[model samples]
Target: MAATQYMTDGQGPTISMLAAGDASDMLSGYTLIEHLAQNKTAKVAQIGKLVDEQAKAHDQAQQKITDLQKEIKDLASQKKRIEALVKKYKPQSPSVGMGGVTPRMANVKTVIDQEEGPFPTIGCVRHTGDPQDHGTGHACDFMVTTGGVMATGAAKAHGDATAAYAIAHASALGIKYIIWRQRIYDLRSPGWRMMENRGGVTANHYDHVHISVF
Candidate 1:
């Protein structure tokens, strides 16, 4: 017998052919491609994260700048208010004493004499209206103050000296209506009145003489 001739041929490939195909090498290539794809995805993810971080940082910086600007504006407004308050609290000059009274009556006399001609020796200084004229002791008109020879409205017209001096000094001070109360007699007992009765109590004649200290 020919040594048990029952050997069978494999259906597909021989073991030698399978070995020649190098399965290990093909698997290595697939693995390399997969690794490369994964690396690319990781890189993309990292870039996205970096972009998001940068955007957040930019927003924070912008917000900080806006806040700083608002603070600066608020500080400026506060400074302005402080300046205004200081000005309001400032005291008046010694020239304009309390109640529109001038402390330097002598100085006023000299000024009036120099500007409006010789002042009368004895003049009347009465209030705009009358308590003496109406006899109401409480209706004190303009206040009067004296500085040597100079006289001015105090709150009640002191005597005849203050009103007389104020009226006489009006021209020098550019006083508006020296003639408003022309009926008011001077310290010298002479009456003065507005030459032209324009209207409404000669407009500029407030109760007190409108005098500027400067």
Candidate 2:
């Protein structure tokens, strides 16, 4: 037998209490409830539509994220390339020059290094200011002293005059700036009148005849 429900007050418990107890009870026995059960086919159609919309939105969001990521990667690669080029072309030092090294000087150094074989173990090579400032990167200073005798100077085993001549000759052929022995002057020497008057002699050139291959 079905269980019988008990009534407490003069009237039964109010509908509000039933609603509070279970939300579904508020719709129980209503026409809307009856239709909800009868139209399961319509509910299925609505569910399909909601699922399609959600799938489309998800696909579009994924595509946008992929495109953004690809764009970021491409930009990063370009930035790295630009930075590498800058580093590669950057001057090693300020002494290299403002516009960088001149082709003439590069060629001269190459010739000197290759053709000269080896320089003196005791002697030093002198270099002047930037080529741009001097317009010739070929300026150098070398000295040969005898036991106070200029004639004995040639007998000493410095690089032969032939080697010196080769350097000078090659510089001339290559259009490199090379100050000849005669072109040099020692303004500090006793008869340095001409060079001092012309102001062509630097202090460093006073002890050694200045040679320059610009």
Candidate 3:
């Protein structure tokens, strides 16, 4: 009769006969296959963890981009506000044939400059042969109409208020006289007086409020 031996199959507990050396080799091969399979499973798990970490990092990067865009928009809005303020307060250069503004005239000009109105321009001193307050750097002309034209209705009302304001603050501002709308307010007389028409708006002083300061 042939001799028989018992050994486990690699998959389960089924018994089979084999030479002793052959069984030992088969068992060693089975153990190596099992170890390889376990290693493959562990490698798959590590790859999955790495993929999850990469996905989390991608989400954080997108959030940072969104925050940076909002910051840029806010900075642009702030820049516009600063530019507007700069334009509003910027100093204007003197026009041709205009210079030599006095200290009192400059002070009064500062006050008028603070008023929110339709004052087109300021002309204080001029080079002329005529003996006028403007030629002596003691006067300022606040124009209401364009090209020395007559102002009407609302424009006239604005000019009236401007002239009145100059007269009202004359004592404090060292203003000697104000001429507007064919009338003159002399600080010496302290009243409005009608003037003879010199045949035009500029000559009659109807298009501007002329202030002479001490």
For each of the candidates, the C-alpha root-mean-square deviation to the true structure, in angstroms, is 21.2, 20.0, 15.1
Model 3 poorest 10 in a row by lDDT: 1-10
lDDT of 3 by residue, 1-214 (tens): 0111222324331122222247776676567557756887899999999999999999999999999999999999999998767656766423333467778887787676555243777777786644398887888778777786789887788788888788778888899998888888999989999998788888787887888888
Ten-residue segment with the worst summed lDDT in candidate 1?
Answer: 131-140
lDDT of 1: 0.42
Q: Clashing residue pairs, candidate 2?
A: 137-214, 138-212, 138-213, 139-212, 140-211, 177-213, 177-214
> Model 2, range 1-214, lDDT digits (tens) per residue?
0111243333222333344556665555344445645576688989999999999999999999999999999999999998767655543311222133345545544344344322221112333443322443343323333122231354233334423554446535343322222342222221212322333222323223333433
If candidate 2 were superposed on the true structure by all CA atoms, what would the RMSD be?
20.0
TM-score of each: 0.35, 0.29, 0.54
Residues 1-214 of candidate 1 have per-residue lDDT tens digits of 1211222234212333334458875566556556756887899999999999999999999999999999999999999998666555544222212232333433443343343222223122334542132121111123222222323353234334445655565555433222223243333334564444324332222322322221
Task: Pick the winner on TM-score between candidates 1 and 2.
Answer: 1
After superposing candidate 2, which stretches have Cα over 4 Å from the reference? Answer: 1-34, 96-214
What's the residue-level lDDT of 86 in candidate 3? 60
Clashing residue pairs in all predictions, respectively, total 25, 7, 0
Residue 202 alpha-carbon offset, candidate 2, angstroms: 27
The alpha-carbon deviation from the true structure for residue 37 of candidate 1, after best TM-score superposition, in angstroms, is: 1.7
